[model samples]
Target: MRPIGLLTAAALSFLTSVALAAEGKEGMPQLDFKNVLLKSQIVWLVIIFVVLYILLSRWALPKVGAVLEKRAATIAGDLDAARQAKGAADAAVAELTAKTREAHAGAQAEIAGAVDAAKAAAAAQTATLTARLDAQLAEAEGRINAARAAAMGALRQVASDTAGVVVSRLTGVAANAAAVDAAVGSALSARGLG
Candidate 1:
C-alpha cells in the first residue's frame, strides 16, 4: 500500500483504540469478540487475496514472461549474426593476404626475368666489342708488316749506292752496280739483317 494510505490507516486505528480506552475497554477492538464487523473483514480479505493471485497467475505474469522470452530470443539472434559477420570478415582477410602474396611472387619473377635479359644483352654486347677489337688488331699488324718490308727495301738500295760511291772515290776505279749489290747483300746476310 502507499505510505500515505498506510499512515492514514494507522492514525484511524490509533483513534479507535483511544476511543475504546476512553470507554474503559480492556483490550484492542479488532481482537475483541464483541466487534460485529470482524467476520466480514476476514471474508473480504480472503476474497481480495484470491482475486489478486488469480489475476497474476492467469494474465499479468504470463505477459511479463512472454516479454522476457522475446527479448532473450532477439539477443540470441543478434549474437549469431555478429558471429557470422566476423567469420566472413576473417575469410576475406585471409583471401586478401593470399592474393597479396601471389602478386608479390609474380612481381619477383618478372624482376628476375628482366635481370636475366639484361645480363644476356650485356654479354652479347661485350662479345661483339671483343670480336671487333680483334679484327682491328689483325689489320694493324698486317699494315705494320707491310711498312717494315718497304723500309727494308729502301735501306738496302741506299746502302748499295753509298758503297759504290766510296769504292770509286777511294780506289779511283768505278764499282760495278751488280758487284756492289752482291757485297752489300752478303754483309747484310752475315749480320742477320736481310
Candidate 2:
C-alpha cells in the first residue's frame, strides 16, 4: 500500500511540473543593467526588501514591542494584586482567629467570676440562715422553760389548797393553825420543796 501511494505521488508531481513548464511565461521583458542599472529587477527587489525592513523596524516592530510590554506589565500587576489580596485574606483570617481566642478567654474568665460570685453569695446566705435558726431555737427553748416553771408552780399551789380542804374534813373541825401547818409541811414534802 505504501509503495503504491508513493508511486502515485511521484506521477502527480511529474505531471504538475510538465504542465507548469508548458504554460511558463518565457517571453517576458528582461532588464538590461548596462542601460538602467539602478532600475533593474534585482535592484528593485533589494529596494523593496530594504523598505520593508525599515518600515517593519521603525513602525511595526515598535508597536508590537509596546503591545507586548504593556501586556507583560498588565500580567505582572494582576499577579501582584492577587498576591496582595491573598495576604490581606490571610491577615483577616489571623485577626479573626485571634479575636475568637480572646473572646473565648474573656467568656471563660467571666464565667469563672460569675461562678465564684454565686458560690460566695450562697455561702453567705447559708451562714445567715444558720445564725437566724440558732437564735430562733434559743428563744423557743427559753419560752418552753418559762412555761414549764409556771405550770409547776401552779400545780403545787393547787395541791396545797386541796390537802388543806381534806384535812379539815377528816378532823371534823374548823380550819386551825396546827392543821394548816401540817398541811403546808405535807405539801412541801410531797413536792420535794422542803
Q: How many backbone clashes does candidate 2 have?
A: 0
Query: Residues 13-109, candidate 1, lDDT per residue (tens digit)?
Result: 8898898789987557557776668888888999999999999999999999999999999999999999999999999999999999999999999
Root-mean-square deviation of every model: 6.9, 9.3
After superposing candidate 1 on the true structure, give the runs of residues whose Cα lies further than 4 Å from its correct spot: 1-12, 21-74, 97-101, 108-112, 169-194
Stretch of 10 with least lDDT, candidate 1 = 26-35
Off by over 4 Å in 2: 1-39, 117-194
Error of 2 at 60 (Å): 1.3
- Which candidate gets the maximum TM-score versus the true structure? 1
lDDT, candidate 1, equals: 0.92
Clashing pairs in 1: none
- lDDT minimum window of 10 residues, candidate 2: 25-34
Clashes of each: 0, 0
TM-score of each: 0.50, 0.43
